[model samples]
Target: MTKKVVYLHGFASSSQSEKAVLTSAFFARYYPHIDYAALDLPYAPDAALALIRQHIGQTTEVALIGSSLGGFLATCIAEQLGCRACLINPAVAPHKVLHQHLGRYYHPVLQQHYEVTAEHMSVLEQLMPMTLKQPQNYLLLLQSGDEVLDYRLALDYYQGASIKLSEGGDHSYVGFAAELETIANFCQLA
Candidate 1:
């Protein structure tokens, strides 16, 4: 049985994200047997899901690690696939939150320009799970100082799941490397 782990980056982000790169390296160095991939998801939510599906075809032993909006997508995929996931500073309700930020934007890291529209928010709303079917399958990592998002939302949304809260960390979840071991154990990488 081949175990796999996929790292999903956040909105307007890419596989080259710092966290994604670190995770890929960590998995490569420590868990050589488990296959690991961090793909650059498309800008659109639907396309992103499609890309993830295409990449993960027929893979049984899989775990997901998602950040921000990627965490939202990972939750949706994890529920559909019945896999475990680790959410880092996840966006609990990006549809409602991002509604105000609808406009053209540029990502320096991705070197791409994209637009956020009402349709995108609609798709995100559709992806939102009304209720968690398997809360035990989720590991929530939250920080108090996330300027971009309100961490309490994740705390409330993922009420029954295992949570690790940190103080004074930014939206990027400062000191993310410290949680790799816990993430590995939760995802059952061994």
Candidate 2:
């Protein structure tokens, strides 16, 4: 059967992100049969979820690759769809983490502006899986040098899952290209 991998970019990020571009290129070059989609998600949490679901349509057995906020969204989607997901430097409890940064936010890459509100946090909280029902379906990737978020949070949160903790990398996940094969294997793209 054919496979599909939907990539979700992090908060304030676009499909043009380095990781997203690399992911698309890797799949295109090596796994030509696999459908790879990196969508530009809306800043609004609810709208983003809606767009992801709409893109997924009725397709079953889809795989997900989510970075940062995308990782958080991937977890929610995977739980609901019972699919495998590769989370890279995923945000843990973003509802709590983003509380301090609540206000108007802008992304220069997308030339978009959006509000960061308590309601968005509430939506995130509701989407969060109190406990992952199928932990084996997830692959958590973390780096120690993430300045934006503490990597330990993901380590503690994603316990009981397959995790690869690297020594040093920023929030953007340095050397991410090297892991493309591993991610593809985990998602059964091969």
Candidate 3:
């Protein structure tokens, strides 16, 4: 079956991110039949969820690919929509981490500035899935040497899910291109 894949970038990142671009390019080169959506999501949690849900509702066979903060959001979406997800060093408790950067920040690639406020954080708290209902519905790809988020957090949180733990790599998830085919295969039905 032709599968649909949604690629969600990190907090400060966008659809134009290196990972997003490579994901898109990979499907374009190999799996041309797939449907893909990678947007420059708004910082607000509600807005981000709305955008994700809209695209996902359009397809029955859907999978989510999220990185960092995007990984956090994907988990929420996956539970609600009953779709499978692949998290790239996803954040288990972004509220705790985001609180550290609750102010104006800039996205160099998008060339836009935004703020992370307490109100914005409240939305994040509301959306966080207290428990993953279907642990089998996920594929967690983590790098131990990540400086931004502890890989152990994801390893613990997604305990029952399929996890690929690498030795030493940064939060950006080096060598992501080599795994696109597997990601595509996971998103489809047998």
Residue 150 C-alpha lDDT in model 3? 92
Candidate 1 residue-wise lDDT, 81-104, digit = tens: 889999999998899888988999
lDDT of 3 by residue, 1-190 (tens): 5377889999988888889999999878877777778877778788888988877776657888999999999999889777899999999888888888788988776687877899888888888888899999899889998999999989888879999999999999999988787777777733
Q: List the residue pairs that clash in candidate 1.
A: none
TM-scores for candidates 1 onward, in order: 0.94, 0.94, 0.93
- Show model 1 residue runs off by greater than 4 Å: 106-112
Tell me the whole-model lDDT of each prediction, alpha carbons only: 0.90, 0.90, 0.85
lDDT, residue 23, model 1: 92
Q: Give the per-residue Cα lDDT of candidate 3 at 186.
A: 72
TM-score, predicted candidate 3 vs. hidden true structure: 0.93
In candidate 1, position 95 carries an lDDT of 95
Candidate 3 least-lDDT 10 residues: 181-190
Give the worst 10-residue stretch by lDDT in candidate 2: 105-114
Q: Write the per-residue lDDT of candidate 2 for residues 74-105, one digit (tens) a residue.
A: 99899899899999999989898887778998
Scored by lDDT, model 1 comes in at: 0.90
RMSD of 1: 1.6
